[model samples]
Target: MARWKAYFSFKLWLYSFRLKKFLGYWLAVFSVIWTFTEFSGYFFTAVDGSPWKPNVWGVIGLGIVAAIWMSRPLLRRTVLLPDQEVMLEIDINDMYARQDGAWIIPCNRCFLHSHIDEQAIVVQFRNRFFPSPADFDQVLAQVLQNVPYELDTVRGTQVKKYPIGTVVPVQLHGTRQTAYLLATSELTSQGKGDPNLNHLEDSLKSLWSYIAENGNTEPIIIPILGSGRHRLVVSRYVIIGMIVKSFLAGLAQRKFTKRLTIVMQPKAFIHNQYNLDEIESYFSCAGKFEFDSKGL
Candidate 1:
């Protein structure tokens, strides 16, 4: 009897949590109500009374309640996904060492950092910690010597005077390699973007294109673009959503496999910004991905 009770309790728990089972119960209840309404309508018509009116109202009310309940689960699922699968810690002093097919390099002059992948590197510059152009150039030269491709030309620094939320993809050391620099004006002026969705879209689109072109065969390393001291006020959810949307859009256009590695500096900040639910939601929406923590 105890075993039977335990089994029944498990079944009840499953019924309550499983979406299919919950919907099934609602559907069955509605079906029975429909049948009763049909029979009562016929009987009431014969007796000169209306029984179908209450049945119709009940169905509408039940549907509204069911819809509200169903939405709760869907919303939770959407918000709980993980945006970036792999997360690594990077330090300024040990930036040259290779880990998992990539290197995390810290800039000498500014808070700006670079994640060097097999084919390319993503350099994130926070306006709050602006590095001199010469300092940036020197670091780039040093980093290029260790990379696989030859440095030809550096492109896309023309719009440096623009506001926060500007993303410029430049040709670094020629056309063989590229470095995408995401600059947010908020970090420079007040620290944060204008919460403009279009700005986020533009930034993601540029990053996505770069990833789609270069990251098909090699792993791409990225940083938490705007979550630093520059834009310290931004919500993790919004940032996560923007990253996920951009990656998905970019991935959809690609015909090959890609591995993206996102590196976070000051790891404690990222941990505080996002929780397990956001990470889970990002993965669920992203399809196939993995998560790991790397200490630099």
Candidate 2:
């Protein structure tokens, strides 16, 4: 029953004009193939010497071809940028369980590891990567030793707050892979995260710079920053656009990672109405943007 529902959902998406331009190109290709095959029977006559006419079987075969072509956009959730080795994906899965590459976990400026809730991504990172909370803090401390703090305050749980774009690469246990703890959100007086668009872009820039120096061309998995608890006053789609734009700008300067996956949980994908086809379109057109040293 669930499979049937999913099939219908895909069917709705298939012809919904979300991928209309791609669908149009594929349909044109199939039409040319059919036309060429039909005319080929005239010149390269078979033993039977019968001209092939459009029949039910041919129509069914064409339908199958069309279905396969349309399904390509919906089925394959990843896209490679034009003339670039870097691959971009919009994966609908848990970021931790999906890959072994460096994961970017958006964190508050304070770099607090003990105060996050059970549902936060930071807590999930601790549970998945570390054997215990102490181990997580140990790795975090080792990475943040060189990172400078912007201000010192006696208020809230943390006294020192790191600047925006501060990235702490946490070396996972028993593996050489690293997970970047990116400080994208500012810690407010009430202990809530205060993330803005400018800060998000800065954090991403810092993330790519750190990865370029430290990463080994491994795939990097990142969630849509500011889409979670920070709740930046922007659409999830816009946040995704920002992430891709920043990453591509970074890529222009140097090749850091071979692949970059922008992970969205299944719930977020459904609730936010994210279309991978649309994301792919956005990424393909990203070539026009110039990479400036200031920001994307």
Candidate 3:
């Protein structure tokens, strides 16, 4: 019964209104080509008194249309802002893949939450970039060595509390890409990840500032903030909206990276059932806001 429900859900998305909008684009293009051939006889011509046979061409056109429609789910949506200098891409892929741009790793204020499970993106990123835990820690220590921290806001077992929205950049040992660690949560004295929506917003703003000053105009890649273990009692869609809004708002203050890619894991993408078309529309609407490209 569960399997049947899942199957039906998949079918529903296959014919969803959002998918129709995408398919409409390709279908219109096909129509134009088909009409052009009818008038110009570009590919098909009448032979001996028999009219040009469109059967073969029609089959080929339908096949091409089907291929285009089926490929939609496999592709992500990308949008360029008004200035056209920056771009935003949304994709369902592995963030740990050795991409060219820098990535944002959400970390606790302490920056040393060693409880293992508490670190989701952090752990995955470390395993991919560093040889072992010790190696990653060595690099982290060096990066945070002189960084200032706050004495208050200590909760439960956490002692030294770094203020939220702290951004620290760590260059992966072997790769040209850098990992910008943003403090979005505080480690509970028990050493669990504790985060709120406010913190996430602040962290995103700080992230843009750091990127503008130090990101060197490289593309910035990030995962959906407030997801996984951080516990923001909101849907992934809302979290995505918040991230977009904050990033755009930051852009208003000053231009940051040339591109920002939001990478969502395949599991999260399917389980959450994100409608890319709707998200794309939201991005377009968000871009309409008046923004100052110059630094404030």
| Candidate that would win on TM-score | 3
Cα RMSD to the true fold for all candidates: 17.9, 5.4, 5.2
How high is the CA lDDT of each candidate model? 0.40, 0.74, 0.71
Runs in model 3 lying further than 4 Å from the true structure:
1-12, 15-71, 150-159, 291-296
**Model 1 lDDT tens row, 1-296:** 32233223433233234566556766766777777777777667633554544557778578546744653222112222234333222221111122333222212111233322222222333211235545665654453444343112112221113332233443433324434455332212222233344555555565555455654344444554455433335665566555655555555566322444444332333234334333554555454543111100
The window of 10 residues in a row where model 3 has the poorest summed lDDT is 2-11
Per-model TM values vs. the true structure:
0.39, 0.75, 0.77
lDDT of 2 by residue, 1-296 (tens): 32233334543365334455656755676677677777876677556776755564675577557755665435236777667677887776677866557888998888775766887899998887678999887777777788777665424443678888888877766787678889998877777777688899888888898888877788899988889888798988898888888888888888988888888766665555556667777767766667575646
State model 1's lDDT. Answer: 0.40
Candidate 2: residue 24 Cα off by (Å)? 11
Backbone clashes, each candidate:
22, 0, 4
TM-score of 2: 0.75
Which structure is stronger by TM-score: 2 or 3? 3
Which regions of candidate 2 deviate over 4 angstroms? Answer: 1-76, 150-155
Rank by lDDT, highest first. 2, 3, 1
